[model samples]
Target chain A: MELVVFSLLNGVLYGLLLFMLSSGLTLIFSMMGVLNFAHASLFMLGAYLAYQIGRYTGFWPGLVLAPLIVGLLGAAIERWGLRTVHRFGHVAELLFTFGLALLIEEVVQLIWGRAPVPYTVPSSLDFAAFTLFGTTYPAYKVFMVLISIGMFGLLGLVLTKTRIGLIIQAALTHPDMVAALGHNVPRVFMLVFGVGSALAGLAGVIGGFALVTSPTMARTLGPIVFVVIVVGGLGSLTGAFVASLLIGIVQTFAVAIDFSLIDLLARFGVTVTRADTFYDLWRIKLAQLAPVLPYFMLVLMLIMRPRGLMGTRET
Target chain B: MPIIRRALLGVALTLAALPAAAQDSIKIGYIDPLSGAFANVGELGVHHFQFAMDRINAKGGVLGKKLELVPLDSKANPQDTQIALKKVIDDGIRFVLQGNGSNVAHAIVDTLSKHNEREPAKAVLFLNYAAVDPALTNDKCSFWHFRFDADADMKMEALTNYMAKQQGIKKVYLINQDYSFGKAVAAAAQAMMKQKRADVQIVGDELHPLGKVQDFSPYVAKIKASGADSVITGNWGNDLSLLVKAAKDAGLNVDWYTYYAGGLSTPAAIGQAGKDRVKQITEWHSNVEAAALDEELDAYKKKYNEDFYFLRTRNLMEMLVKAFEQAKSADPVKVGIALEGMKHQTPTGEVYMRADNHQLIQPLFVSTMSAGMKRDVENTGLGFKTDGRIEAKDTETPTTCKMKRPSA
Candidate 1:
């Protein structure tokens, strides 16, 4: 029971963190139709900048300042870099961002070297928030959950309630109609791209504290964000949220349940012979398969629900 | 017409002298991961190899030929290593050094041993600096391959020997990166612990994916719940550092026995998280007071801007030079014969390659990190203090290798 509770809680926290990064990509992909391959690079930049800022001014200020710097830089990237590449079509824009991701990784390594930086949780939030069934949970984890929920709420309010948010939504469904009605579609596209990047930056600031702050943080988190966005349907924010939690919970639960395929097959009266050449394949437990579970969900979602769980339009 | 003919003759003579100029130096291939997740450790090792050669070159050329190190990036992949090996062989280099991943080492050893069998005249010697897979020196051992670092079982034997004497440590947890090397460590530790201290309970055993985990908090949570008093792991690089950091943040104050505690950037990366609790089993630590290698150590550290990490790398170069001097030839076959049973002196102690397995038996140290360290890497303001030293003779384990030597 304790295992179930802890795994679910941690899984939700992890899913929320994924949502924090995936939400921006969802908006940008849905509104702008650009995949933003370097989105995770911006996430890495935020982590590295936060690590640098936290080294001087402390974590609280780093929390505020790092994302702002990344957000502004992101806006500049949309304004100057992506806008310039927009003329070359989506394929070209994706290639540019991919190249940019490699360059950003090199730059990070050049500055920080190829090892993990000591970007630890601050002493104030370093202690456990509370003990659960004799297990201590760090306060920083709760802080991550709070910040992710807060961002989701703010994003929800901005997309659904505000005037520009209404325009972005209208553009999502009826870009031609909105453009025909004289809305500056390019401006809306840039806004979505910039705002989406800021969210990823925010995710990085919190996630770095949760993980190791290193040049490859972006690479580590890059594929999972895509899995979340894709499994949620490319453009559906709510679907991304649902997929995030679903995938997160499923993966977390998979890790906790240590059932081997051979052991499982044995219960059904199928014995695994030691002489089998491929015996090692059957030896893998669910815990070892946890990392690949998200991708399995990805493949299943693409085949079964191409439009995603709650997706309005086909992706 | 006579003047033009004389100019052509001069050009031909100059071109003829080029191969001789190259012949005045022996080119050794140092192949390892240079651009991947393991690049930091690989690059550190390359720097050590280059520095070791510089020291050898200063003392006059070995066999009157300057030892030149040719570095090639293997990208930490076996296929890439094979391609790199072929390229080096094609270039007439008969010796290669690599030591980050045992997978890469296996690829090199297999490729080179096959090459040596197929073409005895062009046989290449694969000198290992730090891949500690027991199979390399045991069942899967190759005649053309020589390991300069102690195998995993030897290090674990030394480690568990020290572990047996400790007062506490009722319950122990075994955690490692899920791979061949990591699995070997866990299997070896479990067997040795059972042999040494049957009463100690192995409360938890887990293997996480290698280099893929972003958060070790859940894993650390599991460790805390296991009621473990001591944790043993073979994790290195960022994986090891993150594990230590997570344990510290969660206030799990268990003693950690690790394989890569003093690896590149790890000790510093752990910082205050592992000041006194983290311990490592290694051939040499930077804090060891070795007066003999002081001058070389000072100059080497100054050039690299980081403390020397791999003592086996230094031993490799020093032994290679001695082999050349004794054999009086730069031929790979002759050098290989000389290196098989070579006894070389490192600053810590004298070590010899066991003739049966080609495993270097060197003095091993069990050390821990703390402040006011006499020596530190990355200015971490920390140093490793030795807890125990296992002499070279004490670390010998019987090998299962039945080497297939080339028939003369």
Candidate 2:
């Protein structure tokens, strides 16, 4: 029971992290209609930036400043870089972002070298948050959960209760109609893109220390963010939230479970040996299945639901 | 009539000069992961090759002509590697240097072997510096390929033998990434255990999918519950770090021994927390002592501004240079022949390419991490102090590779 609870908590934290990055990606896709293949690279940039800033001035200041820098960079990218490529079409924009991703990775390596940077949790949050049935959870994890929830709440408030929020919602449903209504749709698009990118950057700042900041993080997390956005339904924020949480819980639960098909067979009085390759075939461990669970879920959802759990269209 | 004759002579000279220039320059192609997770390692290799070329050219170029390294990014994907390999071949490269993944190496070998089988005279010679799959040197051996690093079987034999001698390690848990390298390591370790000590029980054997694992709690929990005295893994990079961290978090008391520990086993990966939980067997550790190793490593660190992993690029560069010197010609055939049964001193110690398998025979180090150990005077992370050294004498007996080499 304690294991289940702990797993759920872990899932929630993981889900929030997925949301932090995926939310930005979804928003960018909705506003700009460009996938921004380098969204994860921007996150990686945020982490590296945070690491750099943290080296100069403590972790807290670095955390706040790094995301702002990333936000400004994102603004420039949308205003100048993406706009230049936008005229060429979405495919060209995607290719441009892909090239940008590669360039960013090389730049990161040039600055930080190839080694994994040792980004540690702040000393204040270094200790165990609390012990649960003899297992201690670290304080940094709790901090991550709290920060993610706080951000989600803030974003929810902004999107629901503001004039810009109404504009974004209208833009989501009818981009052309919203633009024709005399609003600066391009400026709104740019703002959303920047804000979304900043969220990814924020996630990176926390994740770099939470995990390890390395050049490989972009490659590792890039696909998952895409998966979350796709599985959550392309343009729905609510759908994204549901999908992110679902993926998180599903993956966490999968890793926590240990029963194999062979164990089930053993209960039915069947025994298997190492010489039997088929015996091991069904003996797949849950932990090994964690990574592919999201994709599997995505495939299933695509086939079964067509529209995501909270999606409006049959996409 | 005189003007026409002079024009014809000038055209003839220009054509003649082009062929001579092409013949003078030897193009050696290299395929490795230059853009993905392994890019840094691959970049290091490229840098080392360039460094060697610069040194070689400074001392009068090879065969009185310059040697050019044509590099193709494999992107660490097998399909990408195939494309890169084909591009290199199509570009008219006669010799190739391949990087260290078993599946990718096997693919390149198979492709080259088929080419050699069809046309033996124009066969491309392959020198593999990193792929350590034992089958590549054994049953799946190719005539065109040579491995510079010890195979998985060789390393496993040494590891299991050492484990058998240890008194406290009665039970073992084998956790490896689910791939060819992992399978080979597990098989070799299992075979060695059967031969050396039948009493040793393998409590748990698990395989995690490569590059997919984010959480390692389930594996760690199993390891703890299995009551294994020692754990052996063939995990590298982030997987290695995550596993070690998870195990520490679970407070598992088993001694962990990992092959391919890479940067994770280094001082930078573990910080102060990892000093107690992990011990690694690697080709190079800064703490391990050999003659002039300190000077060489210090020089490299000063040049690069970071610690090197395996010094794999340096090792490959040294071997290539030694082969060039021994052959006394840049001709692929001559260098291939000369590289067979050649010995050279390296930073690790004296290494020789066995005439049989063309695998490098060198000393391997088994270093243990300890708290308060320092790599340099500046104290980089919790350092890895050398607890034991697996000397050249301790290595497995040499086996003759019966595979025949295709004529170039």
Candidate 3:
């Protein structure tokens, strides 16, 4: 029972982190209609930038400044890089981002080398926050959860209450209609792109301290982020939020649970031994299956309900 | 008419003599991860060999001719490795160096063995540097291949024997990255524990996916609940760093966490946060005070702006050069015969390549991060000291290889 509760909490935190990264990707895809393959690379850049800034100015300054730097760079990329390629259509735009991802990876290797950088958690959050069922939870995790929720709330307000939020909502649903109403749709696209990339950068900043800031982190987290965005639906933030949280909890719970197929067979009084290929399936662990579960869920959802749970359109 | 005939005869004789004395340059191929996540380590390996080759040429060339190294990027993938190996073979390279990962090594070995059987004259010689999977030396042993590093069983035997002697070690938890290397290490550890330490109990065994796992809290919590005093793993690269960070964050009381591989010698992998949390075993260390190691260490540090821990490739290359020199030829068959049962001294220590298994028998160093070393150790000049060195033992175990030397 204690393990279950702890895993659930862990799952929620992990899911929230995924959401922070994926929400931006989903928003950008919905608005721009081009899947930015380099979104994860931008996240990696954010983490690397935070690691550098945090070394000199401390962690708190990194938390605020790194995302802004990433946002401005993202704006530049959208203006000069992606916009030029957009003339050739969405496939060309995607290819550009794909090339951009490759370049960013090389750039990271040139700057940081290939070894995993050891970005430490802040000393303030180094201590355990509280004890649950005789197990202490680190304060950094609670901070991660708080930051993720705070970012979600900030994004919610920006999408709901602000004038820019109203403009974005109009553009999201009907770009042509918004352009007819004298709103500069192209500038709006640029803002959304910049803001979306900033969100990815924010996730990277928190994630770098939370995990190892390695070049591989982008490759490792890239597909999972895409899965979350796609599973939650193409244009629905609420759907993305739900999907991220669900995928996280599922993966967390799956890894924690261990039950072999042999155990199931044993319950039915069936004894089979010395069979080849039995060892292969019996040796499968839940944790080993955790990484592929989200993709599996994504495939199932795509087949069963093309729009996803909260997706606005079939994508 | 007589003068013209004499001139034509002299020119024909000169052209014939040129083809006999000057042979084609011996091409050695290197295939490994060169452009991906594992690129730095792979590139370092490449650089070490290139540096060695430059020095060798400067002294005077090998076999009275210059060495041409042909490098192909594997990207640490088996498919890529297969393609690269085929390309090397097609380019008429007889000697190859690889083995970054077990899966890639296994694929290359299997393909090479098949090719060797079909065409004996085109047989390739392999020098495996860092792939430590035991099966490659045991069940998958090849006559044409030589493994320079310690295999999984050897490392596990050392680790388990050390753990058995230590007091206060009760329950052991086994966790590893779910792959060929990880599974092999875990199995070896388990077998060693059962055979050596009866008091030690294995509470839990788990495996996590490679590079796909971000949160290690569940696994940490499981370890805590299992009441294990020690945790044993074979995880390397990013997985090692991430697991240590997560385990520390979860307040898991790991009295001893033995790494079969990973962060064993690389300071970059462990960082400042992990210095106190883990102890590593490796082939070489920067602070090990040996007379033979000092000169090589100084040269490597001066050239590479980094410590000398990534010298496994250099050691392997030196061994290859020695074998070739001893054989007095670049022939794979003669080189293999010369290398078998060969004993040489390395910067690390004396190493013996066993005739039976072709696995290098060398000293293994166990080291811990130095206390009072500041976090800026990479920049501020701090180093690790060797706590123990396990010398080569004579507990002879039969290798799984059945083939005998073909009357060489």
Best by DockQ: 3
lDDT tens digits, residue span A200-296, model 3: 8988888887877888778888999888888888877888888989998998888877876666777999754657566777757666787789999
- Cα TM-score per model: 0.93, 0.85, 0.91
Candidate scoring better on lDDT of 1 and 2 = 1
lDDT for A206 (candidate 1): 80
RMSD of 2: 4.3
Q: How much is A314 displaced in model 1, in angstroms?
A: 2.1
Which residue runs of candidate 1 sit more than 4 Å off their true CA positions? Answer: A87-89, A176-182, A265-278, B1-17
Per-residue lDDT over B209-293 for candidate 2, one digit per residue giving the tens place of the 0 to 100 score: 8877655655665565567889988888777877776665545667778776545323455455466557777667676665566
The 10 consecutive residues of candidate 2 chain B with the worst lDDT sum are B373-382
* Candidate 3: tens digits of C-alpha lDDT, residues B1-408: 989999999998988787543364678899989987688678777777777777777777777776767889999999999889989888778899986888888888899888877777887888898887777778888888888877777877776766788777899999888887788878888888999998899998888887777877777878888999888888776676667767777777684455532332234544554555466666665665666666765686589765555556677767777878999998888888899988888766678888888888888776666655322234423355566777776223457975434444
By DockQ, the better pick of 1 and 3 is 3
Write candidate 1's Cα lDDT for A145-246 as tens digits: 788778778877888899988999898679899999999877787777777888778888887777777877788788988988888887777888889889
TM-score of 2: 0.85
Ranking the candidates on lDDT from highest down gives 1, 3, 2
Clashes of each: 0, 2, 0
Question: Scored by CA lDDT, what does every candidate get?
Answer: 0.84, 0.75, 0.78
**Residue A298 of model 1: what lDDT?**
84
Candidate 2 lDDT by residue in tens digits, A1-315: 666776776677678778877777877876557888999999999999998898889899988898899988888898989988999997899999999899898899888877688776667777777865555567777777777777767777878899888898788678799999988877887888889888888889888876668888898888888888778887777778878888888887777677787787899998777778786687687766787999998888889877777666653
